[model samples]
Target: MPQGSSKKRERQYEHVKDSAKKRGASESRAKEIAARTVNKERARSGESKQASKTSTQDKKSASQRGGERSHSGSQGPTKDQLYAEAKKRNIEGRSSMNKQQLAKALGR
Candidate 1:
């Protein structure tokens, strides 16, 4: 890290310490904030990963719902429908994506 950036972080830490002291924060409370601010970043990232897993599960259920609603003449969504789903989720270049590409883009 650059010297200036390191100093900036030290300043931020000092500010947090001062604020905690001024507000009569418990040691535990201060430690909790400290953990969330720095040491727990990885834990927060893990939470986002779990959220993406739930999203994948949700997509699976939604696709199944479409499957259940198909009439005799009406078929389940085709590749185009999957691409549309990708577009709805703001996937990049969804129009150009095939079914497998759409699925990968949607997951990410």
Candidate 2:
């Protein structure tokens, strides 16, 4: 819900916000996630002028981008995140492991 977002981006933000809320994210956190998601998508699609360098160059989806940065803060890595890292590292048996197991295996 930041300023200067297009109508399309605003709709995307609302959808993402609701989805995050359904997944049990706090209100403010949901808003933040939604805003970031919409902004990143806008950047990827060249719909926004305020694109990040990484956002412009990265060919991956928003989910993939989020996974890469999920561990940067206090929150633990998500399953998708651990899987992505494991995939990058070419770790064996990663596909079969759950989030906790993957975290343990990755020494996170």
Candidate 3:
């Protein structure tokens, strides 16, 4: 037989709602996470009707902005660690450099 009407699905969905209410995750939060996941999947699919070039640029700029906040509120690397990475990478003139300077130099 064909799949039954959505009545069963709706009942199961109600159970899903009850279970979520019993737990701490709210339905709104679930929907927000789901929306973000769907957007990510759509980007990966590379089949959107919009201009691919524009979306590609948008993604690049958004990721660059994210990187700017990635290292905040943390101790970050130690001086010895910096020396080691600089040495490994053969980044010259690091003896007189600071961490931000080292990062910029090594980035190149």
List RMSD in Å for every model shown. 18.3, 10.4, 10.7
User: Candidate order by TM-score, highest to lowest?
Assistant: 2, 3, 1
After superposition, candidate 2 runs with Cα above 4 Å error? 62-108
Q: For model 2, how does the per-residue alpha-carbon lDDT over 6-42 read when each residue is reduced to its tens digit?
A: 7888888899999999999999999999988877788
- After superposing candidate 3 on the true structure, give the runs of residues whose Cα lies further than 4 Å from its correct spot: 1-72
How many residue-pair clashes does candidate 3 contain?
A: 0
* Best-fitting candidate, scored by TM-score: 2
lDDT value, candidate 2, whole model: 0.85
lDDT of 3 by residue, 58-93 (tens): 544445577654675767777678778999989889
TM-score (C-alpha) between model 1 and the true structure: 0.27
| Per-residue accuracy of model 1 over 61-81 as CA lDDT, tens digit each | 434577653466744467877
For model 3, which pairs clash? Answer: none
Ranking by lDDT: 2, 3, 1
Tell me the deviation in Å of residue 84 in model 1: 1.3
Q: lDDT: which candidate is best?
A: 2
Please give each candidate's TM-score: 0.27, 0.55, 0.30
Q: How does each model score on lDDT?
A: 0.55, 0.85, 0.58
